[model samples]
Target chain A: MSSMVHHFPILLVAIPILAAAITMMLRSKPKLQTGFSVLASFSLVPISFILLMNVWNSGIQVYEVGEWGKYGIMLVADLLSAGMVMLSSFVSFLSLIYSLDYIEKRSLSTYHPLFNLLIAGLHGSFLTGDIFNLFVFFEVLLLSSCGLVVALEKDGVTKSTDKLEATFKYLVLNMLGSILMLIAVASLYATTGTLNMADISVKLSAMQAAGNLPWHVFAIGLLFIVVFGNKAAIFPLHYWLPDVHPTAPSPISAMLSGVLIKVGVYGMLRVFFFIFTDLHDMFQPIIIVLALLTIGIGAVSAVAQTDVKRLLAYSSVSQIGYVFLGIGFGSLGAIAASLVYLVNHAIAKSLLFLTSGGIIHHAGTRDMNKMGGMVNSSPFMATAFLIGSMSIAGLPPMGGFISKFTLFDAGIMGQYYKEITIALLFAIFSLFYMFRAWLLMFWGEKRDVKRYGEYSEHSISPMIYMPIMILALMVLILGVYAEPLLSIAQATAVQILNPQAYIDTVLTRVVR
Target chain B: MNNTLLSLTISILFGIGTFLILRRDIVKVIIGLSILSHAVNLLIVSVGAFSGKDVPIITHDEVASTNTIFIDSLINGIFAPMLNGTNPTQYVDPLVQALVLTAIVISLATTAMIIILAYRIHEEYGTTDIHKLKRLWG
Candidate 1:
């Protein structure tokens, strides 16, 4: 109803780019740059919440860039996209705040700018309606994330070369994934005649209804699995994540694990559910089967990990599997469950990673065996870590428990009994690995000075732990007061199932 | 016939790129990435080539080629002129060129960054071998 609301989609991306540029310019004054970037990042929270509220109130909002209509790039913020943007902006803001104290002081000049660019990329990828623009934002995400991984000053546990190794692996694999994405996008364009997603959706449906859909169109749908699968770090394409995620500085690690890989999940949802709706029957089984393996492999590898960060990274792989499992079910209740699962995982996982940063900083080691009973060293971090673990492990009184229950419940409702059975088994795996890591790090005898060497002793800063506390509190509130989130996710799932509303809103009737 | 030729060439480049990526040398892999990206760029251009009118690059004849799939639109061309519903005779699909240009720029930045990363990696690890660079893989 309002013209200003029409501009929110583009503003969501543009504000971050403006913030990055301004943050880069203010680099000479460290305090000003930090304050400005933090303020800018925090400002996105209300804007995205407003965007989400608007979409909920008045259907989908589409912003046509350059007024090119259906022919040029567009930004469509549907319930799914709006909710994802809201989640990323909230997580990025908290991560940026956590970064202020955690990142090395000398590197602050480069850190804030790169971090803002990363946020911009995440928002843009979630918000863009043009398929090619999705590719461009993905590149933005890749480069900025690699830069942060390879260039930042890491804690002692991750060596200089370790970051390099991780970045190289991440870059090469993503490069391969990007090429596949181009092939898919181009071929789809060749067949469909449009890059605009809504326009393409209309054309694609028309083609299928005409009973003349091309074979290559089906191939492109599957090819998207590799592209978004690589981004999400699911099975078969998940090789780079464990190595890459843990080697970055802690705040960056939180972003990677928390929201970045979920980009792939977003891509899958957007491309498959929105544009390729006719092919749902073909893709449903494939996605469910692969998602099951992802859960198994991630849980197994997570159990075997001793490095605290690496364990969390592997656990993320498993958690993402659960989210995908819900997605693969393809029911309204199931998709809603996935959205609920995704939000909980993003919050809980980011909290855990940030807490791990403090733990690593406190214990001066990443190896869990080397970190002994540190509960007394920092009671605040101990409590923070416990809350994050409780939430991620899907224990009662945490957000993850609600999501896990909803997902499994939805799967059962959809008559996916075997899949639910396997998933329930892995849910136990998550509980095991999470509590095991926490106990090994927090409850054992103190770090042995003679056996493992002396740890650097310093007071954990409030700047570091405060963000973790906020996120932890969010997890608690989500678990206790779950109605608002459940209703929102339900609305998002309904929007996802009904693609016509999205197409009609994005491709205005004026075109015909 | 020309579509077959371009598709053949793109597939060959893809094969070469895939092979190079399997090599042990890191620089070779970066080269592999560049070639693979170029192959994708060519694939995009070829997609347009499939839909394009017979411009000077493909032919100089007065009438456009009839073999391409897009010619079906010409059945109602006088009424709609729907090559993307735009004028086909004036130009081939320019959107592909725009898309290719964007892809090229992105791949350029990515390739350059990767090369610098390979160099920094060589400096840090004293090896250009990707296999030897698995320290983070525990």
Candidate 2:
């Protein structure tokens, strides 16, 4: 069992890639492919949980890929990486199950393989200690998502033109981000002569201690803001998100909004807290200003949207702002608050997007104005949406409130009074837009049949509804029993702030 | 002086890439991306170049003797110092070469995907102009 622990990190990434290849071979038979994908995705949840528990019991687990020691590529799983892997696995498993029924048969042939590859990419990025390897996985994520975004659907309601345009914009901006990342990585290596993240952190801190750190190193640190800021879709870089996310199929939308953007947040945390710890004071004010603008823009734009999924996409942007705000506070308690916010938003936002799929199926339109009195038809969906909205709005007895409360508490503790006030004002913007979108869809009179056509008589599938209900239940459970998650997040925060354990583990481990 | 020249060329490439990406034509944007990736790959290679003229491959005789010498030196209270008096022109840094290889492969995959996507976008929208492709906005 102890020996098995060494292989767990690789297995978390390898299983998905192997399953993706097998899924491609079985593509002609959609049923077999779906079963295999579900099994693969479902199995990841336990594996990730076990990995997290292993990391918890023993400190950072470093798996060097070719036994070249720190000179070769490594996969390091500390509390933060392990915790995020668990969260991503849970969300992905549910989303895969939902995709089984929600995604069209024509698309499923390619969807299963692409979805698994996306999971592989996400896991690889989280676990990799090599900065260059992270870039590789990011491209895997970008290409797979691009293919999935334009995949053909049964209803064909989402136009190919819109998908193409969205993909183009997403591709252009992310490519630019990748270029910036490569330049930064290259320059850092030139200065420090290392690629392993832990090694770089150690060398950088040494340089700082000696008071010989070059000014270009500081510039490299700021360049990372563009690399990850584009990924997280903050403020000015967020324009592509509201367009790209809603244009993808709903299940993919759930994945994108729920977990994908968090990759950016994870990158920010890793690079800023670990690699650039010397410049924390310098970067904090800049991050605070950008986060506030992100919240304001996302909230303000969400209010003007009439499309259901588009509104949710914009809301994701605003919620992400709060996470960045917590990070910008640059304290142990504040980072833990950000982690908690990340987990809650992942559950609640995915739930909302999944439910929106069912709603769109019933109404035959994406416009909220075309949807009213939906509760009279599907009370289950109404309840699910209401829970998701309430949670996102920071109402009591929901996970969002706990996350928001802690973030505010951490901000106040950190004495970021002005920034917290602006964030608080935007929180109201979130409430108004979320509830307004919810009421516009579920309350008042149903749209006239003469104009928008009759609501479809086809009932919502159990496969689709089950995931939404489970996620909604998770939201409630998280709110009521927030202790365990909070403790895990706090542990993750401690691990992130102190890079000594990570560096020691990665550098000192004997090559086998 | 070589380092200065390399940095200047990289900056010029970046400027051209950025200028091209802002154009209306989608194909031009793809070209710009390719150019940017090439520049980045060059930058990676430049970062790895030390004052060396030989490949990084170490012969077996050198490896064995160095291993024994390193152990002996450690035991004799003398640290193993390869870079102090050794000829700097013998070998280049191998790690960044490995990094560049991986970067090139990744960029190749991404560039191919983007080109295919650009072609598809042209097919779907019947135009390659980015400004005309705006059906989705707030």
Candidate 3:
């Protein structure tokens, strides 16, 4: 059993994809398809945990596909990748469970398959060691998400036309990102003569040491900002997110807000910290500026949102900026803080989005103005939203507080006063927007059932509540008991700061 | 001169693609995206297309005292004697071919998807104009 552990990384990706195929085959059997999806989704949590523990105890695990060594695709399950997979799997599992009840019957036909493939993509993106494979997984993510977004929901708020428009915008924009990514990657290959990220790093550094590194190599590195920034929804490339997020069903909204954008930050960290560490000094100022703009724009725009989902989507935009700021600082503490911030926000924001699903369920509309006195009818949802909002607002006893505090503390300790000050101000704006949306829906006059119709009894299903409650519990737990996560984050930050460990592990794979 | 011309051609395609995408027409946008992807594809080919290098073509040459063995990367790829141990170097062309092939496949899938989406969007919104497809206002 322990010997089978090496296969966990490939299994993590393969299981979901296989399950997606199985789910598609069982399309006529809805119950069976859903059963398989739930089983697959639930199974990943344990697999990811064991993978994480394996990496923790045994160090980084490298799986070279088909035993072609570095010549073939490799999935490097380092602490960072393992930990990220665990986070994504956990949230996606919960979100998958939530979708069981939230998705309309008509859409459920393709939901499980797409959702499974999406998880497969996420796992693959987190695990793959090759840059080209990263691009493949990203396209997988894009298509799966586009397929999911195009479907209608039970909420009745999303029109088919809206889905079409959002999807068109998403596909077009991401198509541009894809082209840019290929250009960057192809150029990198041209300059360094390799697609394996570790090999590229070694070659680039060797060239640098030999005093003849091409400047276009750095230009290629900078182009990745556009590529990943598009994926992560950072400023200037974030337009597709707000439009796309609100039009999708609620659980998918959670997945998009919670985990998908983080992939961008992950890509940035991978490229800059691990591959382009030399690019860090030059990239920092530019990223910090872009991140600040993202924060300011996202926060400012979030404040003006009438749709609860749109507000959360914009908040995703803003929150990703903070994560980028952590990346931009390029210090061990800051990166660690960013990891901490990322985990907290992913949990809390997913919780809020799930709670919004419940809210949208109860209120019968996504418009916050249409909602009032939700607390009286759905006390459970009220409590959940309160917890999610408080956490996001950086209030104590919720995970967001710890992450936000650590982020600012790291920034201040790094003497990034100017950057942190601006970040802090946006943080306050986030606080206001988060709670204002909360209070407007949960605290005002009694809901007008006569106009908006009755609350959806569908909101109260175990499938929905189970994920929400678990995520809420996780948010609280992350706040109250952060030592384990913090230690892991610290270790990950160290691994990231020192890329030699990763490169050595990858390059030294014995050919079979 | 060829490299310069190739570079100019790629830049021109990029510019044209960028311009077309900015048009209000959704079909134009899709075409723009296609052009951009093709431009990048050509750029990749250009990156590998340095003049006077041994353009590696499939030949079942001697490799490791074997003549008929296939290279692992491709199903029918011949083991190039010049590519492995005896050769002190690696050519960028083969890698570039693989990358461009993957990119082409991906772009094909996405372009098909975007076209389907554009058709659906037109069906629903009654226009291919992106300006008219603004049902999702923030």
Candidate 4:
């Protein structure tokens, strides 16, 4: 392989950092800054696609910083992280483009830099092999996201004070989680004598095989779960999510809900599959039970929500449950199912949030009860919203159907009969709430909707439509022809299962 | 004995931190996070303890002769280190120290950010009680 290929994994993160710095220098020129940031985001697509393709064949690629030995910080772009990078790049690019016409130029310039930084952070969290580096990236992403949420402080709805308060709560709780994770990593390292993931995995297995497992090792793993669960918005630990996600700008919401929470999922899998593979029996069952409860509670809560963004926020909670359900099962089929669901949810849910942004911008309210027959006024927005709804609802001929079906099938295949049964039942409930929000916003007789000064006549910008169209088209294509995507997910799942492949590739000296 | 003492102190701090987090005050929360960090640092440093030896550090050839979990091959052949093939005094678990250092930095950064956020909340809302900030929910 060419030495240049090694630069791709870290560059996925570095490019945006470079872009943000250049953006700061160009800050006096807002339009230019916005243009530069947009160009930078679009550039990530090719880089991400290339990395994903490399990992698809190579299994995993480790890029150690400074050409340092195995003891130093390493960035491993395994199949799983590579795929997430690809999805995140596509979503962030589209979201940036969408923001062009939707937000004021003054706000867009500030927002776009932070947006690029947030994506960079997401890529960092995914690629970093050192556990502590993950914490650093998590903070970077969280702080930038909070900055964007307060960037445009509306007077009443999502006001500055409320945003600050909510962000503070989110920060405090997330910091608590991060502290726990650090403690866990410290404890694990003390016992295992290695910070490299592959090295730790080998040592952990030997400890277990020796029948001398340290009690603190178990505590460390549990602590990691709590931290990751908080990020993933798992039910018991998800109190901050509903408050925080919708409090941000709609484009930011798409990124947060679309990409950020999934980092939690990624971390959980990394710890479980990569670092503590021997502790499978202790952890997997707990995850499965939690998945069941998370799904039930998230769906039940979603049905009762009245605010459009809040409802989508709650729906995200329910949708993430599907991801956990597949992960918990731990079979080849289940992992594949979960992988498919992850991509599908990122697109469908983000589209829903973006459409909600359009609705709120035009209608001047987030309350679904206040919205009426917007379909008559904004057919394109309504149609896009319906397409998003259908995909998320798992209707036939949509990406949601394929992913959800795979998850359910995998659960059954793995003898998780109850899980599959419950998932199917809640799948219907998800459709109900999605359509309920849809009807209240778009289907009723036109009422006295508070129009927001005719929307700059820029609602249909190519940047705005491109993300929606690309995602919508992906949904349709994946629904009809899921073979290629599933194959990619399948290869990734196999890599995740036999995490030795990843550990050996990164920690051991490869024979030339 | 040192290991036992270290474990006890870490556990105690963790307990106190947990209790503080349950309280309503924001200041208490910051203290709770700090206490938790120190507790982790203690737990990490204690994991490398071995009996009848000072902390693992190389001073000279004489110091390198100390019995531990990672004695050199030649010394092990002569003395036969007690812990089976594992020498009891050759290597310090450098991993824990590295983790502890990173944890300290991360917690410090977060603590600083938390204080700023608290000050901002105090400025904007005139109070820090989360229960009173009821604009978004419901």
Candidate 5:
């Protein structure tokens, strides 16, 4: 068991790659592929949980690929990485099952493989100790998601032209971001002569202590905002997300909203908290300003959106702003609040997306104006979406409330009064937009059947509803009993803010 | 002088790439991406830690013998091989080269994906102009 624990860090990434390859081979047998993909994705939940437990029990777990120690690529699993892996795996497992019924049969052949590969990329990006390896994993994530976005769906409701255009924008912007990342990474390597993140942290701090740290290193640190900001879809960089997330098939939308954008937050946390701790004072104001802008833009744009999916996509942008706000606060409580906010948003947003899929399917349109009084027809979807929207609106008795409360509490505790006030103002925007969207869809007069066509009376498959219900239940449970999640998030925050544990583990490894 | 020239060249390539990407033509944008990648790759190589002419590779025989004179004289007076066995700074840094190789492969794969996507976009819209492709505006 102990030996197996050592291998968990690599296996967390490897299992998905191996499964993707196998799933590709079973393309002729999609049923078998579906079963296999479900099995593989669900298996990740336990593996990630066990890995998290191991990290909690022991210190950081470092696995050097090819036994090159710090000289080679290393996979490091700390509390935060393991916790994220656990969250991603759980969300992915549910999304995969939802995809079984949600994705068209024709697309399943490539969808399963691409989805697994994306998971592999996500795990790899989170666990890798080498910054360059993180870049590689980012590419893996980018290309696979590009493929998934253009994949064909059953009803062909989402036009291929739109998918292609959104993907084009996504690719072009992200590719530019990648180039910036490469330049920053290359420059950092030139300055530090090391690629291992832990080694860089140690070397950089030592350099700072000696008063010889160069100015460009700070530029490189800022460059990360472009790299990860592009990923997380913050403020100016968030244009592609509202286009792309809404255009993808629903399960893919769930995965994108649930886990993919969080990758940016993870990168920001890892790089800022661990690698660039000395520059916190310099970075704090910049991050705070960006966070406020992100919240404002996402909320205002969401109000103007008529497309249900696009509205949710814009809301994702707003929620990510709150997470960044917590991060910019740079306190133990603030980081924990951010983590809690992140987890709740992951659950609620994915639930909302999956339910929106069902709603769109039933209504035969993506426009909220075309969808009215859905509770008269698909009550289950209406209820599920209500739960999700209420949670997202930060209403009481939902997980979103707890997260928002904690975030605002910590913001006050840290005494960022003006920023928190502005954030709270935008939080009202969140409430207004979310409730407006909900009221527009579920409470109004049923759209004249003669014009928009009658809502589909056909019952939704359990495969679709089951995942939504599960996530909805989780949102309720998390809100009602927030202790365990909060504690874990607190622990993860402690691990991130203090990098000594990570540095010691990665640097002291025996070279094979 | 060489460093300044290289930096100037990289900046020019980056400027050109940015300009092309801003154009309406999809093919031009892809060309811009390729050019940008080349610039980045060059930037990595130029940042290599050593100015020595010798390759980074060291033979097992060289490791076993530890004859400083034999190894030091192989390269010219630009940089001498440090035989102290404590640091290997004399040889060119191999890590950046390896990273550049990975970056190249990644950019290659991305370029291919983007090109195919462009072709598909062109097929779908019957035009490569990005302005005409705005069906998803808020």
Candidate 6:
């Protein structure tokens, strides 16, 4: 039993993928399929936790799919991946449970399989050893998510048609990204002659020091930035997110905003710190400019949204900017803050979506104009929503405030003046949008009364309430007790900055 | 030398593809995407430049070794060896091949998805002009 602990990283990915297959095979029985999905989703938590503990005790863990010379694929559990695994797995698990009730009214044929596949793909993306394999995992996630969007569209023909169009647009743009990424990977392989990430890093670092022609490396690296930027929803490349996110089912929106976009961030870090650290100085300004723009645009757009879900969607784009800002600072402190903020945002944003699900469920509309005085009516739900909002807005005693504060402090300490200015501006903009949400939904004279007016004053269903409550509590806990999370993030950041540490671990069997 | 030719052709295709992608027509965009994708594929394959080889496998039983066992019989080969090692230093970079194969599959998938998206846009809006679909733009 103890010996099996080493396989946890692979298991995190394998379980969902195998479950997806098993679920598809059991399509004749929806109950069995849903049960298997829930079981599979639940199992990821323990596996991720065990791996997290192992990584905490030891250093990073690596699972080469086969022996390196033979298979050339590896899955590693470093600090960054382990932390993301825990967040993604927990959110996926909770979302599945939430979906059990939420998806009952919706179609089931494609939902369960696609949902599980998306989880599998996300897990694979986080764990993958080689760049090309990461792209494969991304494509799997993208295709399955497209199916998910169409599956959850409302019954009206026009609305469904609109959703279908938006979903197609998302698919096309993502496909464009995939093509560009493949080109970059191929170019890298051509130059380096190896697909192993650690090997490429070492080779590229040597080439940089030798002062040889570095154009191939730089060109490929730039292409990757553009490709991952599209997926990450950076300011200029974020055209698809607001439309696709709101059109999907609420739970799917949570996963896309919470997990999918983060995959892009994960890819960026893997490349930036591991494969391209030597070039960081050259690229720092470019990254800072993009991050600042994404932050400003996301906040401003979020403020103008009347649709509750769209507002949350825009807020996600804004919050994603902070993650980028943290990355732009590129110090130990900045990286740690970014990691902590990533986890916090995942929880807070998912909580917001779940609460929106409650509102959408009760009100049957997404317009905030149609929702008023719900705070007095369903105080439990309203309060939970406020908690998520405040956490995202960086208010005191909540997780977002501490995480963003550390990020800004790190930026200033690093003397990246432009990024600091952007952070301050985003801070003010975030407060505006967040409070605007509160004022419109909770404090107004009861105006739109159709959805919530009919319901008796009672507790929200436990199925829905439990996840949001847990997330809300986590937001507070993450704010107050930042040490444990910070340590995990710090360890991950250290491993990323020092690529040799990761290379030595994964290439344990490789001879110099 | 041959690689340079392939590289030039690919760059030309890529340039044209980018132009098409910027146009408003959906079909042109797809064609542009395909062109860019093929150009990229060409560029990647060319990165592994293979020089004096007749398709690597030598015999049914033995794979091509890095160092050639046979010597030129006329002058230097009866007592001396032409190749230094059993395995040649230059093999078709297997890593690039794998990356290319995966790239092809991903690109194919993306192409299919884009085509479907184009069809859907045309069906609903009755026009493929991107400007007409700009409902949310400021």
Q: Relative to the true structure, how large is the alpha-carbon lDDT of every model? A: 0.86, 0.87, 0.87, 0.79, 0.89, 0.79
Better of 5 and 6 by DockQ: 5
lDDT (tens digit, per residue) of candidate 6 on A1-512: 65687888889988988998898888788888888888999999989988888888888787767654313688888877888888999998888777777764447756888889999999999988877789889999999899787665332211656576678678768877987887788777766656778767766776677676458777787888898888889988997899988878777888988888999899989998898868876766677788889989999899899988889888988888889888877888898889888988998999999888887776556778877777777777788888888899998888898888888888889988776886788788888888788778777676645544553434567878888788888888988887888887877888777788887776556421
lDDT of 4 by residue, B43-133 (tens): 7677644443445454566434543322213222322113335445544445556666866776787788778888888898788776777
A151-251 in candidate 2: lDDT tens per residue?
76555667888988888789889988998999999988888777888878877777788787889987997899888999999987999999998888888
Q: Quote the positional error of residue A79 for candidate 3 in Å.
A: 0.8
Candidate 1 lDDT by residue in tens digits, A1-512: 47877788998899889988998999899989998898889889998999999988988888878876666678889989999999999999998888888888887788988999999999999999999999999999999999888655435667878888888889989989999999999988888777888767877777787787888888999999989999998899887899988999998999999999899999998888988987877898889999999999999999999999999999999999999998899999999999999999999999999999998887778889888778877778889889989998998899999999999999999999999999999989999999999899889786666765655678767788789989999999999999999999999998888998988787663431
How do the residues A1-512 of candidate 4 rate in per-residue lDDT, one tens digit apiece?
Answer: 56778799889999998898888788788878888998899989999898988887666888878765456788999988999999999988888877777666666667877888898899999998887678879988877787777666222355677677778778878877877776777667656555667767877787677677778787888888899999999978877888887777777789889998999899888888778887866888888878878888888888998889888888898889889888889888888889899998998888888878777776777777777778878887888888888888999888899998888888877788877888888899999999998898889775553554233233556766777777778778888898999999988899888987887788665311
Superposed Cα deviation of residue A223, candidate 6 (Å): 1.9
Report i-RMS for every model: 3.0, 3.6, 4.5, 4.7, 4.6, 7.2
What TM-score would every model get versus the actual structure? 0.94, 0.96, 0.94, 0.90, 0.96, 0.91
The per-prediction tally of clashing pairs is 1, 0, 0, 8, 0, 6
Candidate 3, residues A331-436, lDDT tens digits: the string is: 9999999999999999988998898888887777888887888787899999999999888888998888888888899999999999999999999999999999
The candidate maximizing lDDT is 5
lDDT of 2 at A207: 74
Question: Across residues A1-512, which tens digit of lDDT does each residue of candidate 5 receive?
Answer: 89988899899899999999999999999789888988899889999999999988887888888987777799999988998899999999998888888788888899999999999999999999999889999999999999999887665678888898889889989999989999988888877767889877877787787787899988998999989999999988999999999999988899899999999999999999998878776898888899999999999999998899999999999999999999999999999999999999999999999999888888878889877888888778888998999899999899999999999999999999999999999999999999898888988787766777777666778898899999999999999999999999999999888899899988776653
Q: Tell me what fraction of the real C-alpha contacts between chains A and B each candidate also makes.
A: 0.73, 0.66, 0.75, 0.50, 0.71, 0.38
Candidate 1 chain B, which ten residues in sequence have the lowest lDDT sum?
B72-81
Q: Flag the better candidate by lDDT, 2 or 5.
A: 5
Point out where model 1 deviates above 4 Å. A451-455, A509-512, B49-90
How far in Å is the alpha carbon of A91 misplaced in model 2? Answer: 0.7
Worst 10 residues of 5 chain A by lDDT: A448-457
Candidate 4, overall lDDT?
0.79
Q: Candidate 2 local accuracy as lDDT? A: 0.87
